[model samples]
Target: MSNKTPTLSVTIRTGRGKGAARRARNEGLVPAVVYGHGTDPQHLLLPKLELNTILRNYGLNAVIDLDIEGTSQLVLARQVDVHPLRDYVEHIDFLVIRRGEKVVVDIPVLVEGTPMGGTLTVQEASSVEVEAEAMHIPESIIVDVENAEAGTLVTAGDLNIPSGVTLVTNPEYAIVAVNEAKSAAATEDEIEGDAEGDATEAADE
Candidate 1:
């Protein structure tokens, strides 16, 4: 994760219910709640545009320093609710977090390098869950295939995760595999069969 934690200034919302939420949206604000650590959930209003930009730049699990009316609180963007047909963020749920606290997050898995000739690499899982300090969450985990032979399988446990991060995903889970590439002759035969089927359909018509 990037070391830069952007700060957002938000205000506590006193109004409740759908009417108040709708009014907030009309005013270019997003209704949100912050709750964690055995505290009461705080209702707040955040700038819609600013929050969207932050999420786009920092990702869904982005951590932020929330300036709630004057008090500063570190939080994680735990959940986001988007309008189904409008495609805009409607509400957000923030989780209050501490620097050293461990949080479970899904990190992207990237496969690097090419497999041996006549073989192709297939990624079985795109992301894996990991538990890491709130301040030290990694951007992603990489698994190198590098000239691997056919039938080679890479599992979650084989990943070279960064120090201080623990994999929450099952160690036996397959992440990627190298498989034999289909032969050109086999593809051609399938194409010929499709053409023959088309010709028979035309005759029937």
Candidate 2:
């Protein structure tokens, strides 16, 4: 978790429509809306390059200080829409937040070290949900598998989350498990069988 909050400069969006959105993008802006705290939604335009840079550095769970015109508001990124082919941000939804408020968020799970005895590690969940102070959200939760043996199971409850964070995910949900590694001969045989099956299907077609 980082204590730093990236700041973004934004302006009130005056127009609404695909054409307006297209024009905003053409001018290197991203269309976004901010809503929460019993307030009306505010449509705004953000600098595309600056927003991308912030996301790249802080991930999706980033807390940002939105400097709209001259007033500042603290917010959390609730949703983001991206261009599938071009991979650029198309739109964003931000949630207004206050200091010291606890927010529920999904933090990425990271595996550390390797399992022992030539076992293969299977990750069942890539992220876990937790409730924490909106200003103190963790970047990721790490699961240590150092010297773990086959048949070892790591569950969400086994994770060591930072203090002030409460687990919101089911405690028994499996995060990672170690299984016996497949032999090279077995892998080769499986591949051969798959190839034969594909050929037979092709012949039928």
lDDT of 2 by residue, 82-191 (tens): 99999999999999999999999999999998889679999999999999999999999998888899999999999998999999999999999988898899999999
Which residues of candidate 2, in runs, are more than 4 Å off? Answer: 189-205
Worst 10 residues of 2 by lDDT: 110-119
Candidate 1's residue-wise lDDT over 55-136, tens digit each?
8888778899999999999999788899999999999999999988999999989989988999988999999999999988
Error of 2 at 35 (Å): 0.2
Lowest summed lDDT over 10 consecutive residues: which window, candidate 1? 53-62
Error of 1 at 157 (Å): 0.5
Error of 1 at 49 (Å): 2.2
Question: Residue 66, candidate 2: how far off, in angstroms?
Answer: 0.4
Candidates' RMSD to native: 3.8, 3.0
Backbone clash count for every predicted candidate, in the order shown = 0, 0
Candidate that scores best on lDDT: 2
